[model samples]
Target: MSEIPPDLRYGDSHEWVRAEDDGTVVVGISDHAQGELGDMVFIELPEPGMNYNQGEACAVIESVKAASDIYAPLSGEIVQANGELEDSPELVNSDPYGEGWLFRMIPSDPAQIDGLMNAEAYAGQLARILHEGGPINT
Candidate 1:
């Protein structure tokens, strides 16, 4: 089973977001996403100062199994991108919710974060996908 941390909000396509007290939010792929993608090889991180709408493709994650776009979980201006992942993509597989985080942003509207799934909803979505044998957020 995937590690679904209760504190994070989840995107339907598999990204997770954690709101910070400073009005920024951290974003990354969930443990379930990396697990399904097999081993991480490279991640094209977004640039600081770039703006993207909710659900816009911002980065790309490549694994041994396949490559997939990492979308913006909310409309925002990217405040920072994780530089370490450029050198150590495997951090995504090793510690997904911590060191593997992809980017940070100042949301265009903080309330959009609230519209995403909570841990329980995300877990149920994953269960339904698994039971139905649907392809995970590829």
Candidate 2:
């Protein structure tokens, strides 16, 4: 089973969001997502200051197994991106929620994150998908 961090809000598409005290949110694919994708080989993240709508594809992560799009968890402008991933994409596989974080964005509405699945809900969703034999996509 993948680790679902209790502090982060999860998107149905398998992204996780952590609201920062500065009113920005750190975004990354869930551990479940990275596991499904396999060892990450490349990552293409949006430049800081780019705007996106909720659910829009904002970045791309390529793994040895497949390439997957990373969606925006909430509408906002990107404030920062993790530059280290460009040199060591394996960080996604090693520490998905920490050094592997893709970007930080100032949400148009921070409350939007509250609508996402909690850790428990996301875990159940993952379990259901696995039980149904559905392949875990990005």
Query: Which candidate gets the maximum TM-score versus the true structure?
Result: 1
The superposed Cα distance between candidate 1 and the true structure at residue 105, in angstroms, equals 0.4
TM-score: model 1 vs. ground truth: 0.98
Q: Please give the lDDT score for candidate 1.
A: 0.94
What tens-digit string does per-residue lDDT give for candidate 1 at 1-138?
889999999999999999999999999999999999989999999999999999999999999989899989999999999999999999999999999999999999999988999999999999999999999874
Q: Give the per-residue Cα lDDT of candidate 2 at 121.
A: 95
Weakest 10 consecutive residues of candidate 2 by summed lDDT: 129-138
**lDDT for each residue of candidate 2 in 1-138, tens digit (9 for 90 to 100):** 889999999998999999889898999999989988899999999999999999999999999988888889899999999999999999999999999999999999888998999999999999999999897767
Taking every candidate in turn, the Cα RMSD to the unseen true structure, in Å, is: 0.6, 0.7
Per-model TM-score on C-alpha atoms: 0.98, 0.97
Q: Give residue 69's error in model 1 in angstroms.
A: 0.4
Query: In model 2, which runs have C-alpha deviations exceeding 4 angstroms?
Result: none
